[model samples]
Target: MRPDLLLHRWSSSSVVILLGFAELNFPFISSLHIHVELLRGFCSDNPRNQQYPSARIKALERKMQKLGEFKLPHFFNYPPYFTLQPVRDTREKQIQLWKELILDYCKSQKTFVIAIEEEFPLFTNHVIERSLTHEAKETFLSALVSEGRAEWMDKGHRRCLILWHRIQDWADILIQFAKDNGLEDGVVTIEEIRSGPESQGTELHGIDRTILNRALKLLEQKGKLVVFKGTSTDDEGVKFSI
Candidate 1:
C-alpha cells in the first residue's frame, strides 16, 4: 500500500481500536477515546494551523498578570473591538462596554483622571497592537459623562475626571468619615480631610482636589456641612453638622 493510504488506513483503524477498548470498559479508555475525538475535532476545525505565536501568548499572559486582579473581558482582545462600530446598536453596546471597563479599571488602579491624548494602559492592548483612537476614547468617555460616572475636566474635553464613586456617594462617604472620627460638630481643614492622619488609609486620602471640592459642595447644598474659605485654597475648612 502507498504510504499516504497506509497512514490514512491506520488513522481509521485507531478510532475503531479505541472504541473497542472503550466498549470493553477498560480503565481510562473512555477518557482516552474522548480526548482522541477532541484532538480530531481540533485538527479538522483548524486545518490552517491558525494559532497565536508562543512568545506573543506568553507576553499577553505576563501583561495580564501585571493587571493585578483586574480581569479584562475576553472581547477586549478582539481586533474589531478596538475599532468604533458603525452600526447603531453595535456602537451603543461597544460604548457601554468601554464605559464599564474604563470605570472598573480606574477604580481598581485608583486612577482619578484620564487624558484623552495620554497613554492609558487600559486603552491599549500591546499584545494585539491595538489601541483606541482619540475619537473612540472621547466617545466612550462622553458616554460615561452622560451617565454621571465621569466628568470632562476641560471645555475641550481633553481630560476626564473618572468618578467610580459619584458625588453623592462621596458625600455619603464623607459623612461616614465625620461620624467615625467624631467631627460631626467639629471644624476640619480641607487639607485634613484630604491628607490628615485621620483620613489616611481611607478613600478620602489623596483624593483629587477638584473631586473633593465637588463632593464638599454637594454636602454644603444639603446643609450637611459648611465650607469655610481660608487664606489659601488648601487652607479651606469644613464644619460638619451631620
Candidate 2:
C-alpha cells in the first residue's frame, strides 16, 4: 500500500474513533473531536484555508446572537454538564454550580418560575445540542429546594418557584419599598403593592403572588405590618407600623 494511502486510512479511522467516543458522551473526547472537526479544513491543503462553509459560520453566529444579553458560562457547552453526575463530590459541585446559575439566570431575566416539563433556556445548550434530562433537572432543582433557594410549587414537582431573592430578602425589600413610597406608617392594598405605580420599576413589581404573600406573612409575624382581608381579594390591605 502507498504510504500516503495508509496515512489517509489511519486518519479516517482515528476520526471515526473520536466520533464514536463523542457519541458515547465522553466529554474530553467529544471536545477533542469538535476541535479537530473545526480546524480540519485549516490544516488541509485547501487554497482558501477556510475553517467552515459560509452557511455554517452564519449559523454559528446566529446561535451566539440568540443567546442575547444572558451570557452563558463556558461549561454550559460541555455535554457532560447536562447529565447528572454519579460521584458524590462531582455531583455536589455540579448541583452547586447549577443552583447558582439558575438563580442568576432567573434574576437577570426576572423569571420567577420554572416548569420542569417546559423548555427552559438554561436547561438547553443549542450550540452543543444538549439538554438536561428530566431526572437531572429534578436533581438540581431539588438541591436548590434543600437550600431554601427554590420551592416546589406542586406536590408532583412539575413546577418550581425560583426565589432568586429568598422570602426574608423579599421581606426586607418590602420594608424598603414601604419607606421609599412613604407607606411606612400608612395602609396600601395588596394588589396595589404588587402592581401599583410605586411598585413599578422595582424588584417587587410583578413578583409572584405566592412569594409576595409569603413575604407579607413574614412581615406580619414580625409585627412590622398587619394584613387585613377585604371583602374582595384584590382589596386586601396591609398596614405598615414601620
Candidate 3:
C-alpha cells in the first residue's frame, strides 16, 4: 500500500499524531492510533515535519499547574478558545465561559480589583502564549457589569471593581453579621465593621470600603442601617436597625 493510503488507514487511531507533508493537496490523516515513537520515527527523517503539538501540550500543562485551586473547564485547553469565535452560537458559549472563568478566578483569589493594563493571571495563558486583548477584557468585564457583578472604577475604564456578591447580597450579609454579634441597633465604626475583632474571620472582614459603603447605603435606604460620619473623617460609623 502507498504511504499515503497507509497513513490514512492509521489515522483513526486514538493516539495523537502530528504529521507534516509538503504537498498541500494530499489527503492526509487527521489522527493516528499508532505508537508515538513510531510516528516520531516516521517523521524524524522528514525535514518538513513540524513539532508543534508536544510544545503546546507542555505549555498547557504548565498553565494548569498555575491555576492553583481554580478548576479550568476541559474546553479551556482547546486552542480555538483563545480566539474570539466567529460563529454566533460558538461565540456566545465562548463569552459565557470567559465570564464564568473571570468571576471564579476573582472569587477564589479574593481579587476585588482588576486593572486593565496590569498583569492579571486570569487574562493570560503562558502555556498557549495567548492573552485576552484589551477589547476582549472590556467585553467580559462589561458583561459582568451589566449583571451587577462588577463595576467600572473610573470614567477612563482603566480599572474594575469585581463584586462576586451583589451589593444587596452584601447588605444582607452585613445585617446578618450585626445580628449575630448582638449589634442590632448598636453602633460600630466603619473601619471596625471592616477589620475589627468582630468582623475578623467573617465575610465582613477585609471588605472593600467602597463596596461596604454601597451595601450600607442600600440598607440605609431601606431603614435597616444608619451611616453617620463623625467629626473626624476617619471616625465614620454605622448603626444597624436590625
After superposition, candidate 1 runs with Cα above 4 Å error: 1-52, 64-69
The full ranking of all candidates by lDDT, starting with the best, is 2, 1, 3
lDDT per residue, candidate 1, 92-115, as tens digits? 777777888889899878789999
**Model 3 per-residue lDDT tens digits across residues 1-242:** 87544543453222221221111112243221222343443343433443434554344445654487677654443345566666676567677777888888887777889999899987776554678888888878888898889999999889999998889889989989999889898999998988889987787888888898999999999999899989875689989888
Per-model TM against the reference? 0.76, 0.78, 0.75
Better of 1 and 2 by TM-score: 2
Ranking by TM-score: 2, 1, 3
- lDDT for predicted candidate 2 compared with the true structure: 0.77
User: Candidate 1: minimum summed lDDT over ten consecutive residues — where?
Assistant: 24-33
Best by lDDT: 2
Model 2 Cα lDDT, one tens digit per residue, 39-69: 3433344334444455554564456333568
Once fitted onto the true fold, the runs of candidate 3 whose alpha carbons sit more than 4 angstroms away are 1-59
